[model samples]
Target: MNPAPDPELALEVLTDLVRTDLEACNRLIVERMQSPVALIPQLAAHLVAAGGKRIRPLLTLAAARLCGHRGQRHVALAACVEFIHTATLLHDDVVDESALRRGAPSANAVFGNKPSVLVGDFLFARAFQIMVADGSLRVLDILATASATIAEGEVLQLVTQNDTATTEEQYLQVIEGKTAALFAAATEVGAVVAERPQAEAEAMREYGHCLGVAFQLVDDALDYSASQAALGKTVGDDFREGKITLPVLLAFATADETERGFWRRVLEERDQSESDLDRAIGLMQARGTLQATITRAREYGARALEALSIFPDGAERRALAGIVEFCIARAR
Candidate 1:
């Protein structure tokens, strides 16, 4: 059997493989985010500088390379992917009323919700500009549809929030729209830029879709199981928000009547106390819901690997596979 993959090492390998392209993408991100409004760039830069892993953009660059792309188009497109992602983050934080991001005060917290929303709009506009400059209606459609799907996903999450009866199918739909849509677009656009066959492009999209699902699943598990330092955000943020993630769903599935009442009071009623988060975690631990969530993530990760099998064996393919492992390893 393959040795267990290291999340940090897998991430580092993929980052190193696309180091130069990633640098160019970063520079482009800085340049495009600038505006005379001052606050636009300042607030935008705050989140950019806060520095998440840049996994989406990295996927774009790596996907292009894997498709044998030689042009510089992938760099600019990668930046576009990041702009779209950052824009979503800005909007999401406002919606979630999240105070912290990447271990720092979120933009909405620092700049206020109004500016955060507007800057997020500005970033979306910037992403469109990049897409237009690429002059490919196909790429534009892919990313634009993703943007809309993300909004729809967020809205769907709102509909399901505080409701313990959310089905796994509904949860999957929400995540597909909010999280996986852009991942699908990011990787698909690489193939488009490389002028690869449609079959290849679809394969990449499949890989990304599965990977995004896996990534978000692990994130949900970590919310209840990991430290703030390790998670890069507050633990129990989802619980506090009443978000019906997989772990919560799994726990609820097996909950006795008393435990069900506890979930309802905390999640549906939002009547949480200081001890509630601890109790929630304890219940999840006893139910092994966290591990069950991780197991679900691994299943999606396996599908992501299968999607990559269409491509030939090479460093790019391995790097992409490593990404799948990296995402799943977070829960372990």
Candidate 2:
């Protein structure tokens, strides 16, 4: 048997395997992102060409391939998935008032929020056009619903943000709608376009959902542990923004009276001093909450791996499993 692939290289290997289809997907993405209004394409291209890893689109392509699909439609569908994700990123940066994305100034920062939001609307419209062109109601329904769900998730997060009382269940609900919904749609549509059996399609959906949750959890942890270069943005951004991530949730759940006061001051009241982020990290470490979040990530990663067992063993399957490893290993 081939030696287990390094988690770090899993995405590279999968990219190599799916290079042709991905290239087609890229072409489709560029073509669709264009507008008679030059500024739209210019701003959209700025974000798209920035290094994003294209993991969601890759999942769609890999899922189609895993289900033995040999069609061209998956390429366009993968591009559609990517456009939805990119649109969200543009909108999210504006919503968060973020300065940087993918290690560069965010589009909203350089282009202004109005243009960024409009261009994001253009991308969303373009994504639907592609879905319609594919001419499958099932694909349209899946992606359309995911789009609505993502909006709901973002609104829900807004409601929960800076609220110290946000529960773990509520946090999971937010991530599920914002992140995992698209992931599940991306993979499930691959099987739908492939005409796979219902069981296999459901398996793909579960796999993507689990992987997405694990991916977001790792991102939350990395906001504390990773370097600026590793994260492609400033560390402690979530803390600075007063976002209540899993680590913060776990820490608050176990805090004493003094710790609870500190959390409320920072998270709820948004009253923070320069030293607060460091103290927050210290508290999380002392409470083992960061590790606890990572441990929860591992559980989801295992669920992702289990979901893949329904597929026949092959390079595609193995590479997908490596994605799970890579998502969790980033925490280490």
Candidate 3:
């Protein structure tokens, strides 16, 4: 039997791969932003300058390298991935009325909602232009489809917001569309550009879908568990906005009418107290909702690793698998 793969070997490969991608991100972004339109350059630079984990771009780069691609298109594709992500964030902050992101004021907050939205449009156009430059109709198709799905997901989430009756399954579908769709496209496009085999390409897409699901799971968990200092946004911000995330949904499912009423009042009326947030947390803890939510994340992580079998065992495959571990490890 091939013994279980050592995580350390995976970690080493993942760390090195991610580091190389991050190092190259700034230069590549700048080089690509030399548009004739000055505003496009300015807006793209502003969003790119606001540092993120660069996880999406790294996923593309690493997947390409894993599939044996050694071309400059990987760099441009990575930048396109990040541009799409940033554009979503800019629009999200506007819709959510969010004040903070990644430890800084959201673009909407700093530059006003008008500029933020317009700049977001600029990024989207540039992303499309970059994809066109790649000369791959397949890549453009995946990204365009993912972009539409993300937009639809955002609207779906808006409809669900402040509706206490939003089911867990509904929530999952929304997240899969809004979050996992882009992640799936990012890695899958990498494989496609590398001319990977059909089975391997499908596996890479599944890998990204599962990783994205796991990553969003921990984002919900952290809202309840982490401090404002760590989260860079207010703790319980979801509750404040009446966004019923996974943990809360799980807890509410088992909650009695009184507890349900409590949530209804908070969500529908937006009339929450410190005590409301505290009691909600208490109930979730007592009922093991956090643990239950974590269970779901682990299941997704397992599926992500399971999707890697199509790729032959190698450092690239190891690193791709390690990313799943990183996602789940965030909760612990």
lDDT over C-alpha atoms for residue 66 of model 2: 95
RMSD of each: 1.3, 1.2, 2.6
Model 1, 80: alpha-carbon shift in Å?
Answer: 0.7
**In candidate 1, where is summed lDDT lowest over 10 consecutive residues?**
1-10
Show where candidate 3 strays beyond 4 Å. 1-15, 18-22, 34-43
lDDT (0 to 1) per candidate: 0.92, 0.91, 0.82
- Clash pairs, model 3 backbone: none
* TM-scores, all models, native as reference: 0.98, 0.98, 0.92
Candidate numbers sorted by TM-score from highest down: 2, 1, 3
How badly does each model clash, as a count of residue pairs?
Answer: 0, 0, 0
Alpha-carbon lDDT of model 3: 0.82
Candidate 1 local Cα displacement, residue 227, angstroms: 0.7
> Candidate 3, 63: how far from true, in Å?
0.6
**Native-to-model Cα distance after best TM-score fit, residue 243 in candidate 1, in Å:** 0.8
